[model samples]
Structure formats: structure tokens, C-alpha cells
Target chain A: MDKLTPPVSGSRYSVIRAIIITWMTLVILGAFLLDIPRMNILEHTARNLYFHVPMWFTMMSMVLVSGIYSARHLASGSRITDIRARESARVAAVFGVMGLITGILWAKFTWYSGTSVWWNSDPRQSMAAIQLLIYGAYFFLRTTIDDNEKRGRIAAVYNLIAAATVPFLLYVLPRQMESLHPGADGNPAFSEITAPIMRAVFYPAVIGFIAIAWLLYRQRVRVAILKENLTSD
Target chain B: MRLHSGRTSWLRATVSVFLKDTRIEWRSRFGINLLVLFVLSSVFILVFALGQDTVERNVIAALYWIVIIFAATSSLGRSFISEEEGGTVLLLQTHVPGSAVFAGKLLFNLVLILIANVLASLAFTVFINATIANWPIFVVIVVLGSSGLAGATTILAAIIARTGNGGSLLPVLLLPILMPLLLSVVHAMIAALEPGSSWNDVGNDIATLVAYAGTVVTASVLLFDFVWKD
Candidate 1:
């Protein structure tokens, strides 16, 4: 019998983890402290731009990672690939939930400032909620299969289908509708509306969040691999 | 048995499976009966609940699609469940390719939903008094929406049929995948219901529906082997 090696080494993993933690800490600090010209509707809640948008970026990245791994698992039939695919999807769902919550809060304070409206059926928000349901269904499908290999293959097929649908849900369909979100329905995009100074922090915030998501996903994968090794041996 | 004999074999496999399903369904009439009763009773309940007040087209369109989608989600899971239950899946696995089975099942679901939606729309017109202003666009939407729903649900039906508890999970797995199609169809249906809507109004939506159906069907064919073989 052959033994599987870790994809990333111990020292390299530690170094990456250290960088992600420090980078995320800096992004959070900058999110609050970085000063920009205040606007009427946004006010200080504009700071949410740093937190809310990046969750989506991280979620998209995680979903991309998960889908790629699922494809690889289909091609190679490797247990490790299946583990990575499932773990990354789990992380993607976490970020998707965070993105949805942050988005609701941001919209409530800004778009629905005067009223008691929490949800406006905003297209983007609906899309995010639907995305979360897709992820929930994925996990539920996994639980239904008792055989380990059958679960992996079936779940991988469903994951690919779900991933294929994301673009239509998030980008294609939303753009066709009237969304309060930026860059939809012929509105100016974030780049046009945002100040140049904020871009410095926003871009880094996105990258940092994605890196942190990777770190979380890697930790889970490592733990899963350890458990498999211990049980198999 | 010659699964890889090229386009002719593929088409023959697809047609045979489709014919077999249609023949089985024609004899038993189980799927159609269930779907028709479900659609009729639900619309009856909706009409009774609404109390004869003239509903807005927007509300009518929404309700109409809700019924259609629920009808699909509830019944379409049987596409593969019957095969599993009857213990014929092994025979089919030995004879036809997975892609052909997918194609045939997709065609069956497509025809089934077409009948269901046609009956549903008829019921809508009979009870709800909603007039479709644009016939061409309405027909296009009905066809495209059915294909999209059929394409998306066929593969999912295969997946859930493997699990012992399929009835509860089909909608959970389906609604999200079908969201884009539903949204587009509802929007288009609304436009078609309006007094003077044009194809120009729903051009983008029709395109989206087409793309959604195409993507789902293609992805399903490519990935069906993994689910079907093991």
C-alpha cells in the first residue's frame, strides 16, 4: 500500500498562515481607520465596502477552487481531490453566508435608511440566497449516500452542475434585471463611483480575504487527510 | 450493446429509451395522472382562495410559474426512481450509454412538462381569466421554459433517485438550479400577458432561457457517466 503526502509542507504552510493572519488583520484595521470623503447615504457605513464586497470575492474564489478540484476528482478518482473539493465548498458556503449577511446589513443601513425594510428583494441578494441554497443541497446530497466512493462521485457531479449554474445566477441573470447594486441595469460600476484612494484598500481587502479563505480551506483539508490516514492505517 | 457506434447508435439508444418510457407511461399513465391532478387541484385551491377577485397579471404570472415549478420538482424525481425500484437499471447500464439515457429521460421529462404546462395554462385561462396578449412570445416562453426545467431536473432526478429519501431532497436540489429559468420565464410570461407586449420586450429573457437550457443539458450529458456508472 502507498501513502499519500501532504500537498503543502509544514514550514510552507506555517509561513502562508502567518502571512494570511497578518494581512487580514491589517485589512480590518484599514477598513475602519482609512478616511475618505463622506457621502450623504453611505456616511461611515461606507466602510462596509471593505468588508462586504470581499466576502463575495472570497466566496467566488472558494467556489472556483471547489469546482476545479471536483473536476480533477472526476478525472483522477483520487480521494484527496474529493476531500479538497468538499472542504473548499464548505468554506465557500461559509463565505457566501457571510457575504449575504453583510450585504443585508449594508443595504438596510444605506438603501433602506429611513424605513423598517430589511429585505427589498434586491436581485443580487436573491441570487446570493439562492447560491447558499445550492450549497446546502450539495451537503445534503453527500449525507444521503452511505458508500464513501459513491458519495464522492455523485456529489462531485452535482457540485459541477451547481458550479456551472452560479455564473448564470450571479452575473448573467442579475445583469438583465433591475438591481440596486452597482454595475447593474446600466448604472455606473464601482470603479467609476469609488474614489481612487479607496481602491488601494479595497483591492487588498479582496486579496486578503481570498488568501484567508484559502488558509481556512487548507486547514480543513489537512485535518480531513489526517483523519483518513489514521482511520485507514 | 454497441454503445460507441457513433451518431446513429446514440440516436437509436436515445429514441429507444424515450419510446420505452413513453410506452410505460402511456400504459400506466401514472406520471401524467399525478401531474394533471396536482396542477388542477392546486390551481383550483388557488382560485378558491383568491375569491374571484381579478388578480393582477404580475401576481397571476407568479402564481402560474410557482405551480409549474412545484409540479416539476415534486414529480420529476421519478425519472430514474422507477428504474431503480424495478431493478432494470442494471440492464439499462449494460445496454445503453449513460448519455443516451440522459437524453431519453430529458426528452421524456420535456414532453411531460410540456403537457403539464399546457394543461396548467389552459386551466389558468379557464379559471383565472388571464389573457395572453402575445401568442408568439407565449409559445416561445412555454417551450424554452419546459426545456430548461426538463434539462436541469433530469440529471438531478438521477442523482436523488440513488438516495433512498428522494422525495424531500428533489426540490431542495432543484429550486436553486432552476431559479434563473424560473425568473426569466416569469418575467417573460408577465410581458406576454400584458395587453401590448412585443418580442422585443423579452428578447434578452428568451436568450437567457435558451442559454440556461443549453448549458444544463450539455453539462448533464458530460457528467452523467459518473453518476450512472457507479
Candidate 2:
């Protein structure tokens, strides 16, 4: 089987192409419209809402998918399901690294001064780092086991159990602790800002990031299937 | 097909697994003894490094937690490695339900950590000249914190046991997952050590620790069957 293929001329491809074009148009238009004076302070930082938040959103979405696949693999003992879960986890890890980098850039612009530390032990930062570390081990654990079935089951269980800690670390623990990060107890909600026009841009940014993530996920699944078929043949 | 029927049979199977594990662990005390020694030596090193001048109550309390957290990681890493090595995991899998196997292993690790905690606490008190102002609260924190440690470590150890080079991989996998528990325990210990710390001061930390333990234990139990099926 060929590894790559172009889409045939059809309604499905047209619809997909149209959706991508529309998304791109809206993102550009929103950026142009929101660059006006009143919403300009949010310009650079607002750009991050599209990039950074979406990286996190996508990472979380992929991790959730990975966890579900892992559960299914464990319940049914299927190597195919395990392979899908593994691929989802690999993509999640990529998104996680991107999220961290984007978050650091955002933090530098928003929270840091010159000569400040690159990282902080803020509960949110710590917890996010921990979540990354836990999933990092997920891959390590998978590689160490020689038996495919055993490795899948073990990794699946770890994924499901470890996923529980993600919420605690990401949300609960951070909220309980004192931190300089936004969304703390006394901080104003980002969505509650007075700029109506910025919201128009922000919502599209969220959708655009999610769309990009879905595209990446689909590409990964395609690649995995191609590899499976190649090896089987 | 069916492993066993009836609640009593399940309970008996769990106990049998537990006893078998304990007996096996007893025969080869190398891993647990090594863990205890590691804990003791680390406490000594911390005491020396921190020095008499730095021996304030808070610092000592922090050191106490640091020692226990690392010690628990080292101990729990070995909890299942030997079983996997001897093909005993397969044997256990054949005999007991996955849930029972996890329960037996979890209980064994809990008992191991409990001993480690008591011994470490005693060493810490002597070496750091620290005294627990609230004995009950101190014990409560140790139990809750160690239980959380055991729960997280048991699942992780099981996951890494069959992996190549899992010896070092265990701590890499464990520390991040146990951070919340570590933080809560440290806070609780500080409150317990403070002369003026009231129950109100330590209450939140204690509650958080208990919640973590409960959540991890319940999650491990529900998910262990899925993990062990392989």
C-alpha cells in the first residue's frame, strides 16, 4: 500500500477545504478587526490565547482520547486498540511540549521582568510539570516491556490511574495554593473583560486551534494505519 | 474462566495472596532492608548537610518530608520487580482475580511504607532534635501521607515492573504523580511540629492528604483489573 495519497475531487474534500478556508479567513479577519485601539493591549497577549491555550486544550483532548483507548485495550486485550492509544499518547506528548513552550513565552510577556527565573514553583507550574513527567513515563514503561499484551495492559492501567492525578494537579492543587498566575481566587476572569470585539477574535482562535489539533490527530491515525498495513503485507 | 465465587472465597483468595506475598518478601529481605538502610543513611546525610546552625524546626520538618518521599519511592520501586523477575506475576495472575492481586500487593507496600515511616520519623526526631507537638496529628499525617504514597507507587510499580530498565524508571514515573501528596504532607508536618499550631491550622492539609489517599486508592482498585489482565 502507498503511504501517501491525495484526496479525489469530491464533495467531502470540498467541504473539508471549505471549512479550512473559512477558519483561516475568520482568524485573519478577527486579527485585523481586533487590532483597533481599545482592544490593542490584548494584541500580543491575545495572540497567545489562540496559540497557547489551544496547545493546552489540544493536549488535554488528545490525552483524554489516549486514556479512553487505553481503557478499551485493557478491557478487550486488543493490540490494535493499544496501538491507537500509544499513538494518541505520542501526539499528546508533542502537544504537551508545545503547550509548555507557549506558556513560558506567554508568562515571560505577562508575568516576568528582566533577569527573572524561567520557571517558578507555583502550584500550577509544578502540577503541569508533574503531569508531563507522569505521561513521559507512560512511554518509557511501554518500551521496557517485551511482551506486547502485558505492556499494553500495564500502560493502560497507568494511563487511566495517572490521568486521575492530572485534574488534581492541574486544577485542584493549583487553585488551593497561592500563586502569581492568572485565574487565582481574586483575579478577574479572562472572559469577563470589557472588550466585546476581542471576544469575537478569541472564540475563533479557540475553534481554530481545536481544528488544527483535530487535523493533526487525523493525520497521526492515518499514518498509524498505513504503517500497520505496510508491516502486515 | 471464573476465578472464584462468593464473597468469602474472594476474601480468602485476597488473604491467601497477601500471605503468599508476605512470605515471599520475608524470605528475601534484601529489597526492604536495603530500603530501610537507604532511608536511615539519607536522614543522616540530611542532618549533617543541614548542620546544627540550620536545624530550625521548619527546616527539620521539611527535611523529614524530603527523606520520607524519596525513601518511599525507592521502596515502592522494588515492590513488584522481584515478582515479575521470577515469573511469579504470571503465577499470581493465574490464581487470583486482578483486583485481589492488586489489593495484596498494595497492602504489602502499605505495610512496608508504614514501617519505613515509623523508623524514619524516629531517626528524624533524634537527628534533628525535633519533637512532634501534636502526636496524634503527626501520626495521622504519616498514615495518610504514606497511604497515598503506597497507592500511587503500587500502581506505578506494577506498570513498570515488566519494563526493561524499570529500576530507575519507577522513581521517574512516581515522583510527579505523588507531588500533591508530598506537598500536603509537608504542610501537615509543619503544622504538627509547630508549638502554636492548632488543629484548625493543619485541618486543610490533613483533609487534602486524606482526599488524595482515598482518590488514589479507589482509582487503583477500579483500574487494577484492567492493568493486570495482560
Candidate 3:
């Protein structure tokens, strides 16, 4: 593997950018154009499976990238690595908020239709709220400190912890509780229930979203590194 | 003067810090007094808020944990900030290992949280007329949940103490980290308070709380060095 292929610090590739944009455009088209069988519950809105689910996967990947940088920052005591961690977390937070907003819209129409409620408080929803707050706390923590090095080190500790708690908050605790979303004790995931024709779009949607998410993180890291350089000088 | 061995001295230093913290707190009575006031006020507010209506076991359980969590958040953060204020942080840092300091503070936090939780729960039982059928499980939940709370508060206090705005950052950072533990404990408490509940009914939640406390305490010990040394 080339050294430039790494997620932390990578050279820009116009080729990859074009591919991701094209792929995501296709996904957007497929999301609306694909023929999904009408369901008793979701009806046409079940098409949201392609968009809403991948948001979380993309956010999780961003968090993983953040944790990797956090661990690297701790081990190496490098400010640049810490910058990567912080930027990655910021990008992850953007995706997480997007995931949440999209979730609310999807649930609003499908689950809580005709009700005035926007926040239905599903188990997954509850845990995601907690997860987001935990990340939000990281940025709050950063604001309370003044020194750049100290802020990075301290926030890196918090970032690591926030990442560590993700599985527990997002998966373990919610899985144990009764919930409307899939992966509960009795209810299998929508993936299992999805039609064969839908799989084509679904797979591409997930891949395309994840690919674009990676690009966003990479760009964010580039800017962050540039900021760090400008500030240090 | 004769010197003690290294291991014994470290243990002695830890115990002494724990006792010294207790002694200072005994004299000031700040945390305990504030905790009592907070707990009593919250319980009174709840009583007035709920009125004479019969509440479900779930609400009672939820309210109980909410009060304990609030009390822990308000009080437990002072452990490290006091040292910071007194300018003894540097003195203590030069003398003890981070693990020893963390252990000492954690011990004090656990005891303090336990005392506050008991006092608050007793107030709840009296004022709110809340009763639990399974006493032992309720006590277990109290112990385990507060242990996790204390663990989180202890570490968070160390982090917050270093910051300029220690007061507000405590809850913002501490509460979310404590959410998983709090969720399980509240769930278990609801089960334990229900009439038909046995240890069997709440076994999973109890296990989760225990694991939470263990994990947080261990993580604190490892992370304390980073937070405290600076």
C-alpha cells in the first residue's frame, strides 16, 4: 500500500473525488427511482432504508477514524495527530447530527405519522441522543481550556472515552431494551426483510455514503493540519 | 527518622489522603450540607409536584435515581477542586502516584455518594411515601449505581478541576458518560420496586451496573495520570 493512501494524512486524489461524487449521484437517483414493494407499514417511505441507515454507518466510521487519531496522539504526543483526532470528531459530529435529523424525519412520517411529535424516543434514538451529547461534551470540554497542547491532550482523552462508550450506548444498552427499530430480540433487521431488487441500491447507497464521508473527513483533516501549521508558526 | 518500605508507604499515603479528605470535609461540612439541602429540596419539590396522586413504581424509581444523580453531580466534583483551590495539588502530586491519588479520591467519593443516596432515599420514603417490596435489591441498586456515579464523578472532577470553569463542566461531561450505568440502574430499580420483582427479574441490570462501576473505576485509574499530572 502507498503511504499516501492513509486516512490520517493523505494527498488529494481528483480521481477518487470524481468517483465518489458520481457514485453518490447514482445512489441518490436509485434511492428514488428503484421500485420497492409496497409494505403494509412503511409503504413508499421504506425507501428510507438506503439513506437513513447508512448515515449511522458513516458516522460510526468517522468515529473510528477519530479514535485512531486519538490513540495515535496519545502514543506519539504529536499535536498534528491530536488535530486529526479533533477534526475527525468534528466531522463525525456533523454526520451524527445529520443522522439524527434524517432519523426524526423518517420516523416522523413512518412511525409517528399524524402526530405532532418530532422526537419519538425510540431506544436507538435514546442511545443516539446520549452518544451525540457525549461527543458534544468533547467540544464543550475543549472550550474550557486555553492552551492548545493542553486542550488537544485533554480532548483526546475525552474523544477516546466517547468512542469507547459508543458501542455500549448505541448497541448494548439499546439492544437489551424493548425497541421499535430492528435488531431487537425478536425483530430482525430490515436487511433481512428487504427485497432482492432493493439490495442493489442499498449496497451502493451504503458504500457511496461511506465513501463521501471518508472524503469529507480527509478534507477536514487537511484544513485542520493547515490551521495547525499556520498557528504554530 | 526511620523510613517505611515503598509498598507500605504508598498504601499508607493513599489511606492518609483518604482520611485527610474526610477530616477536611468534616470540618467544612460543605459538600454534605449542600447535598442534604439539594436532596431535601428536590424531594420536597417532587412531593409537591406529584401531590397525592399514586405514582407508578417506574416513576418512583426514576425519580429516586434522578435525585441521587443530581446530588452526586453537585457534590462529588468538589473533591479535586478543593485541592486545586487550596494549592495542595502540586504538593500532593509530588508526593503520591496518580493511581494512589485516584484511589483515595474514589474511596472518598464512594462513601460520600453512599451517604447522600441513603439520606435522600430515606427522605423519599418519608415524604413521597414511596415503598419498595424488595429491599435488598433496592439497596444493591443503590450501592452499584452510586458506585458508578462516584467513579464517573471522581475522574470527571479531576478533569474539571484543571479547567477555569469547573462548576458547569462537571455535569455536561459527567452526566452523559454516566448515562449507560444510570439507565440500567433506573431500569433495575423499577423492577426491584415492583411488587413481584425478585433478584431474577433484575439480574441483568445488576450485572451491568457492577460491570459499569468496575470499568469506570479501572479507566479512571489509567486516565487519572493524564488528567492529574498536568
Candidate 4:
């Protein structure tokens, strides 16, 4: 009973891949091409709603995937489940980094312009960075444990505990303090539905990015399985 | 019948573990000694650096919490690390329920934190000449705040034991877990020590600290067995 063999052989997902490619192309086209209402200081970068925000949505989806796989890994003690958990976290981290960079770029030109401040210490920004650090510690923990199975179970428990922190960090902690970000706990949030035009591109952009992240996660898991099987043999 | 004794021994084992841990501390004063020294020196440093009565009440509260947190980081990982380093972890695992072991360690950490903070608070009052406008409110915040810190770190310490890396990794993992607890408690402490501050003013921050403490302890109970055994 080799653990790395596909639990079900030949799980092909090429068709879904094609659909994501097509949807993402359309979302990208709409994001830049669509005319958004002009606002003071925010001018045109508000279209970042389609790009920057979706990066988080996709990152969060991968985190949820990572958490589920971690839970299953503990229950079944399967290396494949462990690999899935690990790879998804790695990919989600990439997206999280991208989101942070893009958020900084967006803020620099708009909110912090003339002030030379890349980071204004906003609660939302600080907490999101901390959330990423929590996951970073998860990956770091994996490297410190040498035993394969022990690493899996321990990292899995840490993953569950880390996932428990996301809500408080991303949503709960930020809301507790005042911030420039819209829809903070203190402010009335901008309901995406009110602006039908931006919402049109925003929803698809979210779906498309999440779909792309799923593809990347699947590819990494496949490679991990082959490596694990080869080493065991 | 065996099940009944199993339950009884579980409670008894936890108390024994708690006793053994305190005795070990009493004998060696390993982490606790370091903590007490850390507390006093930091307070003395504060007095020397900031002139007498020149500091604001809120600043004093903040400084006290910072000292306590650093002191906690120095010692709170000892409960699990002591067992792991002594090679008694597996021995304990065989007899005591994981929950019982965690309960014992958590009890030890809680008492340790309470004593250390009270001593630190006293040092702050005497040496730093810190003022406390609301003693009862400040006490409530300190008790809840310390319990939360202790509970969160105990599980993390168990997790940290599995890693090959030495003690360096504990603080990295601990900071994020302690953020919300730290933020709310600092605010509550600030409010409690400020002149003319009332219960209504500090109520929300205190509530946040209580809620954070409650959730973290529940999480420790649920997650400790897996971390302890695996």
C-alpha cells in the first residue's frame, strides 16, 4: 500500500483549466477597459478593486484548502494529504505576498503620496502581514521536524491553530481600531453590489484568480507525490 | 470500575504534575528566577531613564505590560521544555491523560505568571512610583491578561518541542498568537491606570481580554492532547 499512489487514479482537470484561462482573460480585459467613476485622490487606481482585492480572496481560498487538507491529514495520516496541505500553504503565501505588495503600491500612490510612506501602519495592513507571518511560521515549523509522519501531524495541528487566527487578525483585530481602509469595523463598508460595473469585473476576477491558484496547488501536489514515491522506493 | 479510577487518577495525576513542577522550580528556580530578575531590573531601568513622576500613567501601564510579556517569554516555555529536556515527557504521556498534563502545566504557568506580575506590579509601584487610579479594574485586567498569555504559550511550547530548532522558534510563533490579547490588555491597562477613568471606559477592552482568554484556553484544551502525543 504505497501512500503516494493516487487515491483515485487519473484525476485530470484540464477542462477546468481551460475555463479559468478564458474567464481570467475576460476579467483582465474588463478591469482595465471599464470606466469607473472618478474620485478625489483615488483617480483611476480604484480599478485595483478587480486585481488587488481578488488576490486576497484567492489567497484565503487556498488557506481554507490548506486547513481542510491539514485536518484530513491528521485523521487519515496520509502523506498525500500532508503534501496537499503543504503545497497549498506555499502557493497561498505567494498570493499573500503579491497582495501585500500590490496593496502597498496602491496606497503609496494614493493615500501616502507626498508623504513618502509605503506603510502607514494601518490596522488592516498590519494584521494581514501578521496573518502571513503566522503561516510562515507553519512552513518554518515543517523544516525543523525531521521525522516525516511526526512533522505531518504536528504541522497539521499548528495549521488548525493558525487558521483559527485568520478571522481575528484579518477581520476582528483591524475593526477594533480606526483605519483608512473602507468598511473597517467603525465605518460603513462600500457594498460592492451598489456599483454594478465594478462588481461585474470584481466577482469574475475573484473566481478566476481562485481557479488559477487551484491549478497551481494541484500541480505542486502531483510533483510532491512523485518525489515521495520515488524516495520511498 | 477501572474507568472510575482512571478518571480519579487523571485528576490526581494532574495535581501531582503540578506539584512536581512547582517543586522543581522551588529547587532550581530555573525560569522563575530569571523572570523575577528580569522584572525588577526592567522596572529599575524605567525609573532611571524616565525622571520621577515625569511619565504619563498610560505610559507606565504600557511599560509594565512590556516588562511582563518579556518576562513571560523567558519562562513560559519551561513547563513542556523541562519534561522534554529531562526525557520524562514520554513517561508522563504513558500514565496521565494529555488533558491532565496540559491542565497541570497550564496551572503551573498561570500561578507563575500571577506571582511574577504581582511582583512586577509591586516593583513598578515602589521603584518606578507608578500610579494606579482603579485598583480593582487593574487587578481584573492583570489576572485575565496573564491567564490568556499562559494558556496560549503552553500549547505553543508543546508544539515547539517537536521542532529540532532550539528555543528561538517559540517567540516567533508566540507573537502572533499573543497579538489580540496583548493589544486589548494594553488598552485596558492604560484605561485602568489613567486618572478619572471609569468602568464604562475600560469595559470593552476588558471584555475583549476576557473573550480572548476564554477562547484560547478552550482551544488549548482541545488541541493540547494531539500536540502532546503526536
Leading candidate by DockQ: 1
Q: What's the candidate order when arranged by decreasing TM-score?
A: 1, 3, 4, 2
Worst 10 residues of 3 chain B by lDDT: B1-10
**CAPRI-style grade of the A/B interface in model 4:** medium
Give the per-residue lDDT of model 4 (tens digit) for B1-230.
02233556777877887888888888998777888888888888888899765778668877888888878877886667778889988778877788988888889998989988889888987887777778988899999999888888888888888778756788888887778777778878887778788888778777777777787878778877767885
Q: Give the per-residue lDDT digits (tens) of candidate 2, residues A1-233.
A: 23333223478855875797699687877775556333433445755665666677777788888999988987787666787788888877887788788777766766664647677666755665776897787887777877766877888888888877666665446635677544676666765653666666767776776676666666666676667666654
Tell me how far the alpha carbon of residue A37 in candidate 3 is from the true structure, in angstroms, after superposition: 2.1
> What TM-score would you give candidate 3 relative to the actual structure?
0.93
Docking class of 2: medium
| Model 3 lDDT at residue B169 | 82
Candidate 3 per-residue C-alpha lDDT over B1-230 given as tens digits, one digit per residue, 9 for 90 to 100: 12233544777777877988889989999988998999999999999999999988889988988888888889888888989899989878877777888888888989988998789778978998888778899889988988888888888898888887886788899878877887788888888778878888888788788888887888777777778876
Candidate 4 lDDT score at position B92:
81
Question: Please, what are the lDDT tens digits per residue for candidate 3 over residues A1-233?
Answer: 11122344433577789888999898889889878899877898888888888888888888888889987887777776877787778877887888888889988898788999898657777776887898889888999999877787778777766565555565346535667677675788877888987888988988998898878877877776665556554
Could you tell me the lDDT of residue A31 within candidate 1?
A: 80
User: What's the distance in Å from true for residue B170, model 3?
Assistant: 0.8
The Cα error of candidate 1 at residue A178, in Å, is 3.1
Model 4 Cα lDDT, one tens digit per residue, A117-197: 888677867776877888888888889998998989989888887666555554346635668777764554778323788
What's the distance in Å from true for residue B210, model 3?
A: 0.8
The residue pairs found clashing in candidate 2 are A144-B163, A144-B164
| C-alpha lDDT score of every prediction, in listed order | 0.87, 0.75, 0.81, 0.81
Task: Judging by DockQ, tell me the better candidate of 3 and 4.
Answer: 3
